[model samples]
Target: MTTGRGLRGTAAVVGIGNPRYHKRGTSEDSALALILKAILAACEDAGADPRGIDGFVSYANDLNEGLAVGAALGVREVRWSTMVWGGGGGGVAAAVNAAAAAVATGQAECVAVYRGITEADDGRQSYGKGHFPPLLTAHGIVTPAQICALRTQRMLEADGVPRSAMEALTAVSYLHAQSNPDAAAFGKPLDPEVYADSRWIAEPLRLYDCSRENDGAGALLVVPAERARDFAQPPAYVLSGVQGAGPDWSESLENDAAYTSAGFHPALVNRMWDGAGIKAGEVDVVQVYENFTGPAVASLIDVGLCPPGVAAGEFMTVDNLRAPGGGLPINTSGGNIADGFVHGIGLAVEAVRQIRGSSPNQVAGADVSLLLGGPMAPLVSATIFGSAATR
Candidate 1:
């Protein structure tokens, strides 16, 4: 149960599975079905039987499915089952929590973490309730896009972030999406002109600035590091993980500019780097949450992966993220904006792929990856991953 800056005794991710994405199909696929499918595949990949699972983790009130999904996954015994209370980005925290809990307590040898969500016709309604605090609801901060757009407009004015910056990032995401087979908006990539003229979802945020609502599921199987060599995929050891929460929704506190940035706490970024025993420069690939383009750019700067205010110029370059030999290869599997928002679950799976050299637009010799989990209700999670033996 020893834990420290290094992953000396931490659990490792042994298998990852994502059920096939059906862009337009509305057949009888339920959240439980998708969850089971992903779990079965992940277990098979890890060479572990479902009955061996003793721990489970998922969202508290995930819209796609109910809380009963954990027990229904066929785990013969249960040591722990609890939901991490955050928004879309809670998925990564769930995995980290499960792994840490399993390693700390003598509860289980194997832990299965899974997330399944669907963008069916009724999916849009899921966001309208329970996601925000009383103040946000009272102040009419309804849809997530509107809430983020307000922040983006303020950043645009204060930081002088331009329309071109938005267009460039969104357009690059679309281009990457077009290259991904699982992307919901694959053939619907948008151009700058089209993006500029598109109807606004909220001021300063056009239709293209938001992530696609997608229906998909992702799962990760973790086992004690000592047993990782017997699993399926070359394990991606969890080097470090940290989660942080911001101030409450009070008038001056939540809206204060200085404290506003605190909500997304750059502190977690430092902790992630410190815990991994590596600076941001050592990161080979980055899987940033793309709920909105502004936060995606802001995360790099906040995390010290890029110099302050230079993310738009350095990493946002189309040639940089997609070039044959670019400086930084980001979201090569198409980020959340392009890869289908499996609610940050897709990002973790993508990170594992990059480290394993299985990604479609794989970065050359990428043995390390950085994954960020959200623009949640003032909570953020960051984690570092590397080959299991490194643990």
Candidate 2:
């Protein structure tokens, strides 16, 4: 097998794009328009023509955008197209799909992936239609905050993880966002009491405990590693990528309580590390899905990237120095918590920027980045990147 911190195959992210994270305009742009804007900018960033895109990937929630978004973006010759099934964990799924297609078929020289959300006006709840079980909606589990909060409570109670641990992570996200000009939560610093007393969406989840529902769009351009250098500024090479699903629905496989197999996302992480020829400890940066702060900590422990049960204490502390530009920067772009959830695409766009050192809140000297998506009620994905090394 290949050895050391190098990629196994050939794929690289050559471009990245995003509209402002907060409300971009008063006109309330449609999801299709948001995605198109991001895609065109991504293509320009990659120095590729929009019409030249041979592959495309988008949120399976495309129907939420009222259909035909992919075609409208002009993917008329699409040889590869896919939609991820897992809830809010489709970012890494999209990347994994594109990279795998590029490596295997050798047909698509470039791929464009986009995700966008146009938040409903205040009268409507953000979680509307498709995918979630009727039981969840009928019983009023209509918001992700409630469901994700239950997982957070279970982890804290069963794992003895302190509340301060969660607060620390929340605080760091706010701090990072304050520095990120493109973030929705820009300049908003969340304090301990603010977290402790914010409106309770669920038992342990307060208003600040959840990710903000905001309008935004993000896109990434992927090209074969051999051609990455000619595409964009300081490409981020794809070292490895993997996807997985856990047990049945009743098992509630999103949490440790439901696990009958190996450590949740570790199965996928192992496959990725094996493919990338890098050890878990060697990862320089991580951009894990954080629908809730608890899952963020859970992911680190499950992936073998941190000592068991210590992710909360070690990674989330204000004194710990794991924030952006810190020792082991976790989410330099504020993550879902502060950057605003553009589904999972915000995380992917931030990973690309971190690797490029172009992030508004750049993590200094980030040579390696690990991006993950999930809690996907058992579904998950992991992707690794090294600093444009393949070309």
Candidate 3:
């Protein structure tokens, strides 16, 4: 057996990049331009040669096609390329895992995991084209907000969590965004009164609880850990990663266990922690995807960050999620709710920034960072990253 968290300690992220984030149509019809801009910025950040990139990986719904993007980047040759199948933000962590696996196996030396997104003036980004059917699109549960709201309802009824749990996570994102100039929610002020009266998108879930859509792209470059030191910046070592779904993971919407429960958390967390040789308490920072605040709260509990079930509401406090004095700082780049939601992979860029000591909302001496994407059914992924000198 190759043994012990097979993806751990092999790959390291050396660079991350994002173009100037724009609100929806402010950068519409320019997805291609944004993708190219981020790629060039990532290469520059890594001090890498544009022609030397050998692999590319992305989430399933991504607008940036790898082969085409590589050609545009002036790549010498694309030795390998892959996509994490399934729509929604759940695949972001898996995309990183895919790149790490490629580097660890010698399939490719330099790999990039990216997502490019651009939308119209109203600020809505589509997850996929045409409903992938067998879905509950027929019954008013047509979009992610409604579907996830059902899951949150289950948690509220059976899991004992209150609405405050979701509210705290939402508030934390906006609070951090106020400090991040590149974020779309910057200075917009999602205050308590605004959050309280934000009007429900789905029953208990309010409009403010949903992630904001913006037009932008972000990328991260991965390489073998042994070679990471040669890069221009401090390496964020990939400690471990894994992707999986629950028993009936495909069963979303009606009567499915995942619809009423936290998706893929139990299946992913145990294996990921065992492989990484670390636990939640050891993690100093996190970047949980913010597709919806409800799932994000359930995710915190399911991922071992807090005890399972309802008590997590007390743990996800705004004070605890803020930087510096907090026990665990999360979404310091504002996350999907406050930053731009580029299918959640932009959280990876923020994760790297935290490890590199360059984050505008830096958490002092953070050695271990956890990045999670999903809470989407039948698909969720998470990865642990650390400083080169990290334990």
Candidate 4:
């Protein structure tokens, strides 16, 4: 198999639509109606027709299939539809990558990639409940907070990272969110005092460290770069994208040698950079999947934004990342912790929005934006978007 580097520039994300996200059961529409609304929003952003779309891609364990979506959207014909394989945001970027490959390889055109979740209407998914499919209930390692807390504790002990580091990381997300009226954390500013006093959900992981379980849908419209201008918004070319794990794929929590691994940060750097044909330093904006605080910081390091062991001191400070131009602006749209999670699709839309110069918290001169999925699941992926002028 080729490196798939050729996938670069073959397609572009022309439109991204994220309607208001809400807490569970508050949404006015059913799950399917919410999805259709999101698709229509994306089409409006692209100035393209939903009926013109020939393919679709989605994650969240295929909660809704493409054919049904196509039928609902009144598409002319869906020649193809593909599903990315993880149950949560871990497969978000990969779904976009898959759509790019589909368009590039002539499998389809005008592909709609999306994620529609009704956690609010129903209830929080597996993460909220103590459920880990791989590890039986006997281990007591069921929820995401529990698993990530283990990794964070290990890093603090093994790497000498300060407790303040994690707090700052958690704090910066809310700081950015405060500037975004679209964020769930918009009005609620997270100060050091609140962060310090917040109750601990898991050891080394405080209440603020966890992500919100919101009910919403997010979608993006993708088409060949050459034809993007024929549609609505300025095209953010799909410069490069990839999705993979560190080393172990099927390793269990108790038995794996790399069990303590907090996803694939240090590992995915070289590959993501090399595949994208751009150095990490060239990235103007970053939209990290902040499912929890620790993984987000580790993601910055793993993706090469900062060096190992220096993320906390060098990058986690509020003064550094709060606003654009001080340091790299991450999760400019508030991310999962603050933005409300629809798996990882919301983060991807924010990355595209940054490239379009339309994000709520805009990053200055952002020609290249890196969007990461949940690598902390240890099975993750990412995509890099570039402005139209970028090669």
Candidate 5:
């Protein structure tokens, strides 16, 4: 959507880092401190000097300014900086897209795309209190769970996607989290009985269906693809980074055509796959943003990974979504639902790890990895990462 040769194999993620994750309000470090630590760690991972960082990109209304962070890190210069304008994790992939664009276009040689969250910080606002049209508020659709529930309900009833699909998706993330010590839900295994027994936050959206808020920061260092192999870590090439909303998607609750769909349009999905020169069946793993399980299910269908109708029930089984042997291993880092959510930046980092074959739940021969940002938001994004073989 940015319009050019596209990001396919133009830029590469050389390094990724994150601080120790904590539950909201429990982090000992400030947001700024966490972000700085993450960036420094990324630089170390890449075997690059911190002073080499010349650009910064972030999303979700991040408060850390580029020039300020540059100064803190003693960077040689701040050449470029930008933030994706939107709410929620929808812009996560967009932020990485911007960073890759900067590197590809030579606007800056090394860009660090990062996000930090200190939900307990003073003056922090509840996500549910976001400004909405009176039409939505008057109907008591204030919380995100209530808003997304409507779309999930429609998909189940109208599209005939079984509720078990949502259950399986939720179970998969928790299942993966059990193996990831960094996951907030680590050590807490989820079974179908436990998921079914959980209370509903909104009708059709159970407690396990939602993402957990955590305090942490995550970052990825992007450099030109030619410079990728110089790093210590295996580079994850930027195959494609796509972001946009569907036609007339601004109407939110009133848009009938886009109502039950994830924010990804058919044309957008086509662009991403085309730009990457791959298809849904070619992706070895996916790290779909699990802001809620239902929208994530819709995202999988919208991207052509799963069928649009009752076939999703059979395709989205726990065995089919798990790592190693699953047809489509997803959320290998546990996803936002179980992994620490620093506004979905962690998902991007996990995508890189999958490409590097360093993931705890590594998918064998994972040459192509996909990362889908938050669904059902005003704007959504999806990115594709690949190993050197794909380039």
Candidate 6:
């Protein structure tokens, strides 16, 4: 049942920009400055005047307020300004959804969806201090790695998924990163032996399995679909952007089903594919957020890209996940694991690049690119981007 409605094809991403990426705590610029730079670069990429942008959307409790950013950019006016609630990368796609909705509804003509981060020693790590419920934190499930490990452990032990799949995911991301000059791991390469010997951050999750925190900002411009071709680059149509969590996902660990899953409810996945008027098999590339590799494996299963249980052993090979000739090239810009993790917003920019045929590890003849947001959070999201031919 193809829904074919909603914000599908009503708006398109005309431009994408990332000012620069820096190692965490090494950025000389403030978070706000990085954001402004990214937005201006996006405007330049689209050949759109910064003054024309009237809407802003962001996620992860971004400190840079929209109006403040607008003032910095010297925009004409601030028409719509909003941020998705919650933390982590769960809202990456949701932010894009909000921007597309604004453009589709005429709430704003040109909307910028952006995220910037400059990790301080005191910040981000606070997630382990006060974010979780007392019940879990008391048991030492404070860090995201500890919390997500329980879920991945279940998938590996009870569900019969092999640990090799997770290792392959890590290796493949690093493989793609070697081709992406902007990736933080650009010159670094990871092999099976290196991954196997890496220290364990959590049981079933090695140090290399986790994402690297970086200080950077990424931005993209969205406009009405009809006007997309006027931009400096080819448009990547917003086929669908859906966000929500599965049943009993509130506590992240209380429910057995929810605990083992990636939070992409079956219904939510169905709705996204139906609304896009495309099937999972139609996606030419993918950008699954890798806050950690285990949840990413669960995400692949939940989204119907990889079958449940030990089937992932066969599907998640490094050869099958790499670009150019891979069955489903993923994280073509290296993803959160190998690329700089700018709150997962960089994944969305990579999706747009795949559609525009501008990805550093460009997937040949790619038309549809999918982005799966952070898994196992309070809220999760998925988005699909298509070339103009798909629209």
Each candidate: RMSD? 3.0, 3.7, 2.2, 2.4, 2.0, 1.8
Alpha carbon lDDT of residue 296, candidate 5? 95
lDDT of 2 by residue, 216-321 (tens): 6778887777777786488887777776664443225234444322225445666777877778877777787776776676676677764444445765676553
Encode model 3's per-residue lDDT on 1-391: one tens digit a residue.
1255487788999978887677766785477678778878998999999788899998847766789889988899998799888667878989999999999989999998888777752235477443345556656566778778878888888877878778888888888888999988888878799889888889778998888777888889999888898889999988889787766775443556555555655656888887778877899899998788888877777787855555776787889888867888889988999988888877999888889999878999988989888875447888888886763
Stretches > 4 Å off in candidate 4 = 1-5, 120-122, 127-131, 134-136, 254-256, 265-268
TM-score of each: 0.89, 0.87, 0.94, 0.93, 0.96, 0.96
Model 5 residue 14 lDDT score = 95
Q: Among all windows of ten consecutive residues in candidate 4, which has the lowest summed lDDT?
A: 126-135
Report, for every candidate in turn, its global Cα lDDT versus the true structure.
Answer: 0.67, 0.67, 0.81, 0.77, 0.87, 0.86
| Residue 265 shift from truth in candidate 3, angstroms | 3.9
Judged by lDDT, which candidate is best? 5
Taking all chains together, the TM-score of candidate 3 against the true structure is 0.94
Kindly list the per-residue Cα lDDT of model 4 for residues 24-138, writing each as its tens digit.
7678776677788888999998888889999999875646789999999999999889887654677888888888988888888889998877854446664333226645446
Candidate 2 regions exceeding 4 Å error are 1-7, 24-27, 64-76, 120-131, 134-140, 248-263, 321-325, 376-378, 389-391
Model 5 TM-score is: 0.96
What is the C-alpha lDDT profile of model 6 across 47-72, one tens digit per residue? 99999999999987787889999998
- For candidate 6, what is the TM-score? 0.96
Candidate 4 overall lDDT versus native:
0.77
Please give the distance, in angstroms, between residue 109's alpha carbon in candidate 1 and its true position after superposition.
Answer: 1.5
User: Residue-wise lDDT of candidate 5 within 1-391, one digit each (tens)?
Assistant: 1236888878999989976688888888888889999999999999999999999998877888888888999999999999887668888999999999998999999999999988766234333335367888898877777878999999999999999898888888888998888888889888778888899899999999988888899999999998888889999998998998777874455665867788888899999998998888999999998888999999999999999889999999989999988999989889988887778888999999999988878999999999999688877998899999998
